[model samples]
Target: MIEAISTETTKFRHATVGRTGTALLGIGIALLAAVMPLAAQSGDPRMLDKLGEAGERSWDGLLSGAAQITGAGGLLGFGVVLGWMFGREFVDGTITGLFGLPVSRAQIAAAKLIVYLAWAVLVSALIVGALIVGGLALGLGLPPTDTAGGLARQFALGVMTALVALPVAWVATVGRSVLIGVVGAIGLVIAAQVATIGGAGGWFTVAAPALWALSEGDDVSGLQLALLAPLLILVVGVTLHAWRTLQLNR
Candidate 1:
């Protein structure tokens, strides 16, 4: 079990949080930070006009703007990473070698989740740091208390987004392809948009975090937040089961 755990951990670190992934994450943060000041203006002129009264260049505004960018990226990243982690084993035929290992497949799956969670947290922190630095550089006049609160909220939102994306692992495993998992992730984004546009976003687990991050108001209820627990539990359980009983016959 220890061997399996250590091996999976090392693989995840190399694939997801290694130099290349870290560099990409840094570049994404920098791009988001640079565009935050111009977010309201860089898009459609009509949209900017519509946001005229609400879109001041305040700290909260900047956070929301950055969240809008990072939230989508985070979700996409989660899906892509999970897909790669699981699907690559199948593609390379390494999955067949796990049949009689002393370490169970479930443990390997769990290790992947742990590693991905750690990566997600680190990327989220870097994003928040970049936003703070960028806001300060732009003289956005961020009040300390509000800035602290916003940071906490953003951090929580980022973590929750990663948790919510756990099901993509199962999707990748079942489909045996990363492209399918990416498509699943895209489907999720579309569903979130539809739910949000229909005014039921607060009740939807996937949409709730993004909505919360984009708005300063209390858009989500306690019940809504609580629902995410069961969703995560369900996906994790299903994934472990799938990995344990999987028959890799190529």
Candidate 2:
């Protein structure tokens, strides 16, 4: 099982490398978005506040642009990569090769999920790296003032967001196409935003953890975790369903 998983994960590494064009686009968008704020707010005390002070002096345009690039572009890229990871095996009939192995199909599905998630984290790091480089280039300072602990917390939140997003793996596996998964993920995001604005509580908040995490900026708190928990549960449940699907085929 372990060997099978390692082999599956290596395929995704190759996929990520081969799909560098799309990955580079996401990185470039994030870099430009994060830096544009520094250009607009040069020499202003307001720039120092970063996420604070959103009045007339606010770098609203840059902030909005950053959100758009990271949220929209990043999500799209994630969905496509996930789709490819899950879809290619079926497309090329390599899934049967895995079934011929000693490993259980459930293990195969779980391995693919893990591979998809690792890809998500790696891609996210690339995007964040782009943001850091862009910020430094624009003289916006390295790391948030909250320093070690705060940065750690934010990084945790970001990873949580990415991990919770693995339900898209279910979508990719079931849909068998990256395009459908991308559209479905985007639609879910839009729906979650509407639910949040309408004051609909409960599991709806978990529906869009990444959007909330990014929108709240540095406001990481226990409350956000409370809201995000259900979404994580949903990912786990969906993963089980995907595993079950594989097992039944055996």
Candidate 3:
């Protein structure tokens, strides 16, 4: 079982980790790191006005700026990557090859989920690290305690947001197209927006984490946090069942 999973994971990495994708992800992070702090300190009314501060550089300000990038990036990136990863199999007509392997379809699907989750976590870490380093270099006058707590919250938010996107795998598989998954991802973002605007975002599993990340107070309850786990489990279960019973001919 371990060997089969390892082999499948390697194959997944090769198919997804292309030069263009790597370069783009790196460049996005670099730009976010460099641009966020500078924009905060730029003294432009347009920039400072949104930050709600008049030339006050602090960790909270920097993180608030960075959150805009991470929040949107984390949500969108998960959908695109998952959709592409699973959808590519159908696009290339290789999904049929997944049958009759030593590994079960469930295991292969599980391995893909695991790998993508790891990748999301790593990317989130890199984004946070860059933000921290950039904030310090810019001499944002924030205490270490506040900086640590804020970064930790941001990291958790990123992970939770990505996890909620796991159901896109099932969407891609069932629809047998990557485009469907991407569209579904966009739909989710729209739904989250609607929920937030309606003042019920905390009850929404998809929007809760991002909202919590940007919140300065205890807007999200423990029940809301706990709800995320079951949502993830439901999606994983549905996706595994879809893969296990999927008919290649259809």
Candidate 3 stretches greater than 4 Å from native: 15-30, 40-44, 51-56, 141-143
TM-score of each: 0.88, 0.70, 0.87
Stronger candidate by TM-score (2 vs 3): 3
Indicate the worst ten consecutive residues by lDDT in candidate 3: 18-27
What tens digits encode model 3's per-residue C-alpha lDDT throughout 1-250?
6765676567656764532344344346435645655666666778767656212466776666555555556577678778887777898888878896878888888888887787777766766776666666776644488478888876777678778788789899899898998887787787888998899989998888877877843887889878998988899999999989989778
**CA lDDT of each prediction against the hidden true structure:** 0.74, 0.56, 0.73
Candidate 1 lDDT over residue span 1-250, tens digit each? 6676678778866664344555555346545644555657666777677555334566766676656655567676667777787778877778878777777888888877777788778877876777677777767655478588777777777788778877789998998887777787777777878998999998989888877777754787778878899999999999999998888663
- The candidate scoring highest on lDDT is 1
Rank candidates by lDDT, best first: 1, 3, 2
| Model 2 per-residue lDDT tens digits across residues 144-246 | 5543343333344345545645666777667665666666667655665676566552245433444444455443345655766676667667755765566
Candidate 1 accuracy as lDDT:
0.74
TM-score ranking from best candidate downward:
1, 3, 2
**Candidate 1 wrong stretches, greater than 4 Å:** 16-30, 39-44, 50-55, 141-143
Model 2 lDDT on a 0 to 1 scale: 0.56
* Clash-forming residue pairs, model 2: none
